[model samples]
Target: MRRHKEHSRRLPAGPRQTGPRALSGRLPGAVAVVAAAALALAGCSGSSSSSSSASATGSPQASGSPQVSGSPQASPTPGQQNGGTQLQDAYQTVIANVLPSVVQITTGESLGSGIVYDDKGDIVTNAHVVGTATTFTVTLANSTTALDATLVGSYPDSDLAVIKLSSPPSGLKPASFGDSSKVQLGQITLAMGSPLGLTSSVTQGIVSAVGRTVTEPQGPGSPGATIGNMVQTSAAINPGNSGGALTNLDSQVIGINTLAATEPQTNGAAAPGIGFAIPASTITNIANQLIKQGKVTNSGRAALGVTARTSFNQQFQPAGAVIVSVTPGGAAASAGLQAGDVITKIDDTQVDSLNALTTALASLTPGRNVTVTYTRGGTTKTVDVSLGELGTP
Candidate 1:
């Protein structure tokens, strides 16, 4: 099997036993792309093909002086060399325009990459990259001076974070965000990050899948899961590649690399490829909320504590969430949901699985009332339940 190589490095321990297994018994394609995207953002070694030649020139405006135009430089530096002279020139032009907006992010013991999103130096990165970090540092591309950064907001549920720099460098260029909803399978994509701490790594691949959901384990013993819409790609990802940019051919960011699947082995071992990235739509929603509020809180309908089981009866089987327990003043309790009842639907959405219930509640806010249909003693009943905030259980 041609598996993407895993770049050896240290990373914060991920939740155990999470992520989807590869269908081909190889590394999951999603895992490979996400890891590669993260690594590229973190600055790993990879290949690049040049297609454009444009130069950007500017100097800081004099104090109270008006902006002025200057001729563009026509030559590439020795460090800017690509495969061919012309290609190198084009690569340099693109790099010069894009590099300043990219940043090296260091949070706690975790290191990754991020992109500036606004002129105020607001940077966006994976939440896991800066998870609970007490301090953060941002290194501008082509410069070694590290700027102190503050964690402005974070949405752990969506795996997104935003940080602000104290004093941003001049000519800061924010990356252009694209519509991830339009991304299609087999579309070519590019990833940028620092993999294994190699600054400015870039890789290329195609979108392997879209609208895929992966569940990341929250903790070793915690029964919680982090589920999000993901964009799967075959791009190579490695350690330290977290929070990198996944862009389309137009160079617009469409996703944020997050987690990758490890190779399956008999004797506990780590394998390569199999990467995943949070889709840009989710990122934009979570990021906007993070920017407005310090945290992203979901105001969704409540669920009674339950775990359902599916069993076939002859030629048919009924699936639904079975109530295993009821919280002492929960909306379900107030709505007359009993311990033996099976939830069948919420509003117009069918609830055949726990995943379905969770997803259905995503569009609702807490304190909203909705009708729930259930089954008890082979009889169906409908009741009104007021929604509640998550974590109430």
Candidate 2:
């Protein structure tokens, strides 16, 4: 498994630290701050003496009446209109439209939520969410009925998977996809999922950063690799949120909430406000492929069994996959690549770090010949190597 070093930074913990809570359709933290300031100015006017008398007189009986004679008064509360039920109305609207399409996914021993991609009942989630699941159960958001779902396809390297339900529930409203490429930093974002098995939890935050490359957990047959071009946000994401959607204010999903930074500090304390997600642009391509094909089709390229060190000067920076040994008769061996060689690039792309190389390789397919450039004996050399299918070892 990938071992991520948690960086310690103190930030405000989310309300009710048990995990993220269900949305009450109120303004997010940032928005609430602005709204509160506006309310302060409005409160300065104070209730007019005439308005106070009306309220104390016959208006009390009419206040509970559904029909009002005069123009409907504006809501006194910032988010409440006419009465305090407006917030609940908005919450119901969101829950009604989006909840049906969300499904609780159980794969292997892992469980996470997924959003329906299309009318065909195909559900998309993180590959890690369904990793190696021999069987799957999909539960609708509003109902307790669990339908059997079939594993359509999965790309572990990219951390994406698709499943098709044999009998999906009615009234499924697919989530609208948004452009991740246009997502701006500091824009408000929402995350909806079952964090710690609490269903329908919603958290809010702004886009923290973008283009982050996180290394996947180490697994059999493949070393830890980087997931490139991720969208980082301050939205709280927990274990069960791996496959949940990260949406914008309009409720259009822009990213798939996946990873979070939970590094312990040197003082042995956990930090907050660090989370990550897979961009929707990447999710769309991979999910479409999984729905059509059972597996991802890779352009074949040569395999060089080598790990990399982060820096040449440092004898011990276990960052990249260093070449401990070369597979005999493999592409790297045929290209005169030796065990001591340190790979620094693939084709023209610089790979000074292992994460960079892993990200580059993840974008390429097997059987395609690419230039393998490396440094050996303090000399850099380029060699043409044919790609091979992973797991051939």
Q: What is the C-alpha local distance difference test score of candidate 1?
A: 0.67
lDDT, model 2: 0.68
Error of 2 at 383 (Å): 6.8
Lowest summed lDDT over 10 consecutive residues: which window, candidate 1? Answer: 48-57
Q: Which consecutive 10 residues in model 2 have the weakest lDDT in total?
A: 4-13
For model 2, the stretches where C-alpha displacement exceeds 4 angstroms are 1-96, 219-223, 266-270, 298-340, 345-353, 359-373, 382-393
Candidate 1: tens digits of C-alpha lDDT, residues 114-172: 88888887898876677677468888777788889998886565666899888877878
How well is each residue in 1-393 modelled by candidate 2, as lDDT tens digits? 332221111222223343222342466899777777877767864666447646655455644555343435733555554445764555456555665666778654456888889988898887767766646888777777778998888777667788888986677778888887789999877787877666777887889988876775554212344566788888888767768888876667888877766433224233456778888887887787677767665413224545445545566554233466777776677788877777877888877666677777766666778998877877878889877655322
**Which regions of candidate 1 deviate over 4 angstroms?**
1-99, 219-225, 266-273, 297-393
lDDT of 1 at 192: 75
